[model samples]
Target: MRSVSIPDAVRCKVAAEPRVDAPHHPITLSFTDGVLTMEGELADLAAKKLALERAASVPGVDHIVDRLRVAPARTMGDAEIRDHVRDLLLEEPVLQPLARATPSLEPGVPLRPDVVLGTIGLSVARGVVTLDGIVPSLAHKRLAGALAWWVPGVRDVVNGLEVVPPEEDDDGEISDAVRLVLEKDPLVDASQLGVSTRRAVVTLSGVVRCGVERRAAERDAWCVFGVDGVTNHIEVRE
Candidate 1:
């Protein structure tokens, strides 16, 4: 019989995951009252989820406080990040229906306006993007968060966008968004990808021709809101 400390067990799990790149981004784990807190910087959103998944699977671990951050995709100033995020939201075709119309605002055209609380509002300070507003459905909220994550040079995203007349969220909703995003991604072949979700944890399976496609599928899953964990089992074969 072997008794491994909780911290050691978690460490081994994270280190064994090649996607985590544990040596570059060291995760500091602290266990207290059955809650595990992971604090550190990770290379990407995929790595952050992978590390959290590892910690959650460890025996005796109950909850996790994700203090992990993904290194910004690029380096830019506060103003630049804010503008990029705003432009992205305005550019999304699916979100056009939610775009509020104003005096002198043309129909069927999404415009970039100042931060409006009730509608889509945007702000950035110190590389963190804060989205404040109301969306119609859970899919919209998740889509908004994913778009913010796509912006270059964003360290973190605070998804404060509230769902108006709240609707129920289920694994089906998450799966729908996952598939939609993957379909929209030019780098990914969604036709060959299988997506499923349980308890907000998404599992991606099926086959792709290259590692880049496999990684793209995983990233799309991570971008979806309500996704607590992502298991990328998509095999790469040429």
Candidate 2:
């Protein structure tokens, strides 16, 4: 297929999204073979996600390669920031219940102390937050990571929480779940895309009209119960 030159209207469309902070960082957009690449820095993850969403909404954009970085406006000492994050975790409504669960220990059976979401551990160095331990579900893990990022001085978050659900689904089940989600999502047309899974990794391929559908498909796949990774290979045919 011959690649179309990126339209100036598309570039204008992306640049016109509402800015998140006072001094907006520029996002450089480039196109090749219908894939639009967004590169540069933004104030935070929210802004980055918004930028990508805007890019996807453009009429002819197919796939988007996001290489945006998040840079916080201010910095705080590691100790103070760590304390703040710890308090946030302790106070989070969803995590409070999990935090209150008692650790179980049985004699002659090794105690897996790190098996609960409440046992999340946090450490900070040079503004980076490292979260480690176990969570009951992927939602809890994401909550911990989001809390870390929400802290004032956090530069980056390393979420190492392990999800140990009571039962695990096989690859086929995971694939089916992702496909169903894509089919149901208003933003994505599943008939125009392909979904496959192996070892919990999902690969989305085929063609879509714009970037939003492509990203919406990937986001839905990631939200599935057992998806560990998503490899989106869908092409934009617009």
- TM-scores across all candidates? 0.76, 0.42
lDDT of predicted model 2: 0.67
lDDT string, candidate 2, 179-212, tens digits: 7666656688899888899876789999999998
Could you say which candidate leads in lDDT? 1
Q: Write the per-residue lDDT of candidate 1 for residues 1-238, one digit (tens) a residue.
A: 8998898899999999897999998999899888888988899887887788888899899998878888987899877776677666766787776654444235454544445433777778777788878898888888888888887798878888889989888999999999988887788989998999998889999999999889878888898877878888999988
- Who wins the TM-score comparison? 1
Clashing pairs in 1: none
- Segments in model 1 whose C-alpha atoms lie over 4 Å from true places: 1-13, 30-36, 57-63, 100-114, 189-192, 205-211, 231-238
TM-score of candidate 1 versus the correct structure, residues matched by position: 0.76
